[model samples]
Target: MTGPIWLQWFYVLFWIALISLMAIGGYFMFRKFLKALPKADGKSILDWQEYYIKETLHLWTDEHKALLNDLVSPVPELFRDVAKQTIAGKIGELVVKEEAKQLSQDHIIRGYILATPKRDHKFLIKKLKERNIDISPYQELLK
Candidate 1:
């Protein structure tokens, strides 16, 4: 309150700039930390996902891939790629588990549901219903 008008504005701007920089720096640091942390069976989450995807790449038919894209369409463009990859990774895991000959609609639906956060189940349910896909088989997962 005792400072000149210019000094007061400068103080405000300086704090704003400092906080912005700190937030940006923290975000990058957190991303690096996540990438370093080990997940499933000592593999980092990224590595685990990559392994599943690579192992099942041959099984992802064009139709199955398109369905996956449709399932994640509700996600914002900014996060769609990550969402798609995560869902695909989950789907890949399911395919491997079942020893499936090829990707199926059921596998796609189950994987999308499993990979999505619980809070977003409503959106998923709506998407499935819109596509005329039966939700009865996956009721347990929606809950």
Candidate 2:
């Protein structure tokens, strides 16, 4: 009759297995849910378009978003931040140009190029300078 203890042990083992499976499944589902949810903070390139709203889109909103989306992926997000007064007007000229500048990876800042990329870094600096961002000292590095 004490052999019935084996059955109890079996039941306990089965319960432990089931509980573990449920917990693992729940955790994975939660992770997927978080991925699918919109990241309105714009912390990543994938979060930008999701956060962009009709009201926030200004002056060729679709176009700006289309171009802005290019900085990331088919689903763009970003960590960029700006003065939150009126994002509409500021988004296009101010943000767009600055975003383009940032995308080049040249790190153009105040008439100087600090850190440069490996390949095409010169081209990026040249492009920024052509846009009048002023990347001069780094050009000397080329020499």
Which residue pairs clash in candidate 1?
A: none
Mind giving the per-residue lDDT tens digits that candidate 1 earns over 33-114?
Answer: 8976997679887787898999999888788888888878889998899889889889889999899988889998999989
| Model 1 Cα shift for residue 85 (angstroms) | 0.8
Q: What C-alpha lDDT does candidate 2 achieve relative to the native structure?
A: 0.41
Q: Which runs of model 2 end up more than 4 angstroms from their true locations?
A: 1-3, 41-143
- Residue 95, model 1: lDDT of 91
Candidate 1 wrong stretches, greater than 4 Å: 1-32
Lowest lDDT 10-residue stretch of candidate 2:
107-116
**Residue 121 in candidate 1 has what lDDT?**
85
- CA lDDT for candidate 1: 0.89
Q: Where does the lowest 10-residue lDDT sum fall in candidate 1?
A: 32-41
Candidate 1: C-alpha RMSD after superposition: 2.8
| Top candidate, metric lDDT | 1
